[model samples]
Target: MTWKVLLPVGEATEVMDTLYPIFRLPEDGFEVVVAGPEPRLYHGVMHEIPPNENIPWDITREQPAYHVRATEAFRDIRPEEYAGLFLSGGRAPEYLRYDQDLLDITRHFFEAGKPVASVCHGVEIAAAAGCIQGRTMTTVAKCALDVTQFGGIYVDQPVVTDGNLVSARTWHDNTPFLKEFVRLLKASVAPK
Candidate 1:
């Protein structure tokens, strides 16, 4: 049977962070299902440091918008229906971490010991949901404290996998992170 994956959607979701898995997961035969606070189009953002000093340092990166729609809502999702879950990066997690429904969905994967992957600011959701305890992960350096504060070992690596959880610091690390995640998903789907 083909596996299903839950991808949480939100405003300002980092474009590369969200899109890489959206396309890659399906290549491995897992259906990527987007979910959000509501089942509708969510805006995506691009992040990159400016090479020109003409731009303000505080606004080092340029932000461009893209639209992504969610197929379902967290409150209505059945976590067991999916074989894996992927949490994406962006400023979205700063607010999404507070969402009770999202938190519940985040918890289900960890509690079930299912395949889970998170990148960049996505660590905030896992930390907020109390799923990072005793696990090791890597996120954008700024969020290193968030993971440690939540009792997770914060490593500064391109990819880190502990048990069924896999993480990457940023889009630059997506290649390795996605490779490991696909391996885990395939291993799970392999005949036991």
Candidate 2:
């Protein structure tokens, strides 16, 4: 049977963070189902530091990029149908965390011990859902507080895996993050 994974996203979602998994999961025989607060196309953005000969930006800059469509809405999601969850990062999580339905969906993954992957600000969603308490994880430095404030141990590493939860500091760490997450997903479905 093909396994389906849930990917939660919203406007301003980082392009690389959102698209990589959308395409990569299929290579492992997993279907990626994009979900959002509502069913529609969300505006994605690219984030990078501006290199200047005279002045350098202190943080990543955001620019409009692509539009990704959510195949399902958070309110309609049946979390049990998904074999895992991927929480991509961007400015989106700054607000996506406010949606009760999204938080509920996020909680189901951790509560059931399902495989979960999170990158960058994506940790905000899990933090808000109160799923990270006592879990050691990593995220973009700026979001480290989100992990600590929620009672999680914030590791400043490219990737950190705590049981079923695998996390990366940013999209740059996607390779390792997805690697570990896929392993967990496969193990979950392997017949004893």
Q: What TM-score does each of the candidates earn? A: 0.95, 0.98
Q: Of the candidates shown, which would achieve the greatest lDDT relative to the real structure?
A: 2
lDDT of 1 by residue, 1-192 (tens): 778999997888988999999999999899999999999988898887666677556532748778888989889999989888899998888899999999998899999888999999999999999999999899988889999999999999999999999999999999999999999888866889
Give per-residue lDDT, candidate 2, residue 70. 95
| Clash count, one per candidate | 0, 0
Per residue, candidate 2 scores C-alpha lDDT tens digits across 1-192 of: 899999999999999999999999999999999999889999999998877737788789999999999989899999999999999999999999999999999999999999999999999999999999999999999888999999999999988989999999988888888888899999988897
User: Once model 2 is optimally superposed onto the true structure by TM-score, how far is the C-alpha of residue 105 displaced, in angstroms?
Assistant: 0.8
Candidates' lDDT values, in order? 0.90, 0.93
Return the TM-score for candidate 2, rounded to 2 decimals. Answer: 0.98
Off by over 4 Å in 2: none
Give the TM-score (vs. native) of candidate 1.
0.95
Q: Please give the RMSD of candidate 2 to the true structure.
A: 0.9
